[model samples]
Target: MSANGLVQIEGLTPPGNAHRKTSKVMLLFPPEWVPTAPYLALPSLTAVLRQAGHEVVQKDINIEMYDLFFSDTFLFWISGRLDLQRRLLEERERRAALTDQETDQLALLREKCTVEVFDLAERAAEAKRIVRSQDFYDADKLEWALNIFREVMQYISAAYYPASLVFYPMESNLGYRPGVSREVFACLEDEQVNVYRDVCRQLVLPVVNREQPHVVGVSIGTQMQLLAGLTFCKMIKQAFPHIHVTVGGNVVTRLQEEWPTHPQFFNEIFDTAILYEGEHALLWLLEALAGGRPISSVPNLMYRGTVGVETNKEIYTEKTTALPLPDFDGLPLDQYFVPERILPYLATRGCYWGRCTFCDHGQGYFDQYRGVPAHQVIEQVLALRDKYHCRHFLFSDESYPPALFKKVSQLLVERNAGIKWTTLIRFEETLQDQELWYLAAKSGCCTLYYGMESANERVLNLMDKHAKKSVMRTNLMQASQAGIWNHVMAFYGFPGETRDEAEDTRRFILEHQPYIHSVELFYFVAYRHTPIVRSPEKFGITIHKQPEYDLPLDYYYTLNEPGGLSCLEAMEMAEQFYQQDFHPWAVRVNAREHVFLYISKFGTNRLPQIYAKPEDRLRGTDSVSGLVTWPVALGEGDGNKEDGPTMTRVVSHASGG
Candidate 1:
């Protein structure tokens, strides 16, 4: 058992053919996600299954893979793999000329091999310590630690050339298109570039072998995690043919229409897939697997029958008010890369404003929107806070509805919850009250992410956002003046949007740059299920679908008229905005959790020290200066002496201790 009484199962004796009342379920959260906190899906599913009197062992292999990457054992293993690859390339060169790519890779391998593995491993371990201890509050130490993580990822990426593995942003590509079914299947079997296969063998298979679970469910939440989640499923199915393997999450839900035709994916990769909300659907599936109910009666399930792939008739949507608090038992919460524990809680399901033209996030839900009342939200928040001994939270809501936003803020203030929180919100006119922002900040609202998709009023009308420039400006001004960090998300391209309209957005952001603390700019994607793609003619665009992308959720597109920016122009505009106008939001701390902690620690949004120095930006990378390859030594400071200004000491009574 762990220190907090959470069950820490290393292994279990193999289950015999004995009968039991409840099934043993092993829930796995795969890699390529943010490693700072536990995802809410596993805990949400685990809560229901355990409440139904079943056994569950929830493993977060995402954080484990990251944890493993920076360890002495894994680094030494990477060194050996690099050596083996270098020898193989030398042997190939003896017979034939090396390809350009192979020649460059061999040079990289030799250069990386020169770094002292023992020293790197020691620094890597220390980096983990720095992030998990009081040293994290020191910006200099924390920056050095984060650089070590990036360097370690660079070393590991050399083992699998052309994969382009990365540490942050979750953009690691294994040189395979996840949207193509054949390439997806091929990626699962590739021995050379598929790092997830090794991750599964090292960290996942042993637990499955020892626990002998009756069901293994993998949650593939994002496109980056699809390869890793499917790899774990395929390997589990191969090792134990009897264990029922299932996959679900937002990405899986997006591809629900394509799963029925992919029979090879149904039986070979995973036996079944749960769609939409999975709490009760998965529980009912367990009942079916246990012979208590007919398999056809289970809701939101897709499986292969004798006639081929079969989806159940009933689809399930969860009621937000009726659900239990997400149970985070059996997860190694302390192992996250933060000094304090930040728990994720969902107060609402689905986007409240479900009319964005370029969004497919609403496709994951069968229903539009539902939320718990403010009273119950506070009760649950207090319960979770006291029970876990944590004061920080990430409200994982799609968008904080205006009514609940005010009431929840009032309750947090009146009840004195002592909780620091952050969530995504819409720029509603109802939130125009400046006092509301202050109340929220007093109630410990450290950051708010807004989906200000476009500042052009005409473009906003086209996208169905309908947000007024006045309200958007007021929201940013009030929130920032109240000392809350404002993170604004905007994209450059939309169908029927002119170049002048896109420039309007750029000018507005630059004019209001002080209010917007952080920004995420991107070119719009023509998602497969969005309203724009459903009626391309209405948006004056044509979506070009590739035949190979049979399981596609997004597409390339072209404008039907000539006034708007082309796809290439949109890409160039976004790139230029970052290169020329993104200095104000270029943060040294990029991760959301890291930024949240910094905001909470200082109790303000104007964190000058956290912003990158002008010279640092000129260096063209976010790592510690001169530490990319090899450095003679790391600097030492409390971020006060010669590094920068001294940080205000705030007592963070968080749960990681």
Candidate 2:
């Protein structure tokens, strides 16, 4: 123990339980559903637990699981064959145009065939020893995940029908951003399911037998993580009858407010559930468990008993300023893998302007926003830098309240905190304070990720996103002028958007190409219990109904009524927009050296000329051959018919106008 005579923070030592002798806690990091990036949440939570005088051991099941599924040589061979089959199916679809009735029937048949193929893909992916055999895998529960994936795919595919055709696009939200190939999806799904099952077996069983802690806590983020957490909890209870299990994470926090009261929920897993920010709720639950007190008094806990779930008072306590900064020393720093080891620090919780209709923060769970004191933030940064040698800091605030950002920026400057950072901020707020931007740059702010959900004013209004498109554009331009990289987060296929609106978004991207460094897009997923999900009819969309306990990873609905794009058509349009406009722009901008050379040779004036005749421009004899023709005058009789008067004026006017 330290000088304070508390329990020494070290390795896993089971907690104090009445029935179990050894007391240990195991913290698990779930598999990567979106990207194969390093797990940070587990390490951060481990740091917090260690600081609280609890011995914590973390297991990143994602990496191990990924390796087990993808690294097998035999599986690659099988996956290649699956890809060939999928291509054949696509080719067949392209070669024929069926009547609407025939199209509907064929779509159903195609869905069935795809489901069967996915099942085989999942099995082949899990064929390795680390995930399948009893020695490394749980023999009885191995098929549990395979079954779940098969059912989820079938259910979601059937529910959404042809509309979900765009589920796997060429580019996605993951870091790799490669086309969603059939083989790749098979490989990823296999890895996700296997990792979850294997980790649950290894971690949960060990904790159950050797370290039956008072509570088994699972952290969830994505749908895959939620499934794994629930399955693991079920297994834990089966193995150790007396132990109670709990779950808390972003997914859980979002779901628990209007948490469904299905029988499957109580019969399947988890004795108690914690919703929203779990630090305080978990601490209170642990205290009650250790003191042998009743669980009903525990705030923010949903307890499941013989009768039903008994939820305690929803806690909305004031944010504690004195909460200690997460201690990173206890975690395996070397094992942590990200594109960059971005040390995450949250200056606040919730959003200052939580008005977005689709955002969970504006809902019941995360309504309050709180900021940490600037002095404390600086101190934490100093500790992170000195102790862990961190270089890049990722501020994980909901919106990084502008006032707090200003204070923190000033403190960083005052304290000489040499830390490079990136954060999420509101465009309107950034425009409101230029001094904050100046100070932020002085304090090593490298990038600002701005939320501009849609460029169309009507779409933004429907989504309850308060910021105007005009303000967003102006702020983005100013941010570029301030020498800060701007990453725009956009969404497509909101309920009321039309094909025309999507076209407008595409146009907006082209018009403001200079300011946006990168773009991230997500197709809307109607989350359960949200106002959008509950009252989608009011938004002029039909909500597809699914089974009570069934939560689909890619749940979507169609805006088939008057003012919206049909779900399938909207998705196809969005995909086309990405491929035709957004992606090409990203490719051009990201090729920095090439873009620089082009700009230098042709000047900005020649950009329109190059874009107009891309085929000819690309076929130049050499790089210099392309550069030599920049000053050529285009008279009205010039053979460039595609270069209309409007194009010529756009090119010429920019030179002076």
lDDT of 2 by residue, 1-657 (tens): 334332222222234543422224565555533211233455555554655566655655554443333333423333443355445546666888555754664555554545444554455444333222332223233223323333433333332233221111111122211112232223233432233334556544764577546667777654434445565666676777677677776656555633445444545566677765565566556656665445665556777756777677545332437556665554444432222234556666556776666654333244355566777788877887777776567665656666677788888888888777766677673454555566777777766666676789888788776667777787777666655666565656778887788767767777888887555443555655456777777887777765432433224577656766676675566556544454323221121112222233332212432231344334432122111111111111000001111110111000000
Strongest candidate by lDDT: 1
Q: By summed lDDT, which 10 consecutive residues of candidate 2 come out lowest?
A: 648-657
Candidate 1: residue pairs that collide: none
| lDDT of candidate 1 over 1-657, digit per residue (tens) | 345332222211113424435899999989876788888889899988888789999999999999999999999999999999999998888888799899999898889889899999999999999999989888878888888888888888889987878766365779999889999999999988999999999999999999999999998876767889999999999999999998888788888889988888987999889987888888878877887667887778899998999998776667678778889878998999999998888887766787777766656677657788999999998998988888999887767788988999999999989999988788899889989999999998998878787899999999988999999999999999999988777777788888999999899989999898877665777777789999999999988989999988688999988999888898788778766777666666657788899889988898888777778767655453221111110011100001100011010000000
lDDT of each: 0.79, 0.50
Candidate 2 accuracy as lDDT: 0.50
For model 2, the stretches where C-alpha displacement exceeds 4 angstroms are: 1-23, 33-52, 63-195, 199-214, 238-243, 257-268, 314-318, 338-340, 361-367, 429-438, 535-538, 552-561, 585-657
Question: Which one wins on TM-score?
Answer: 1
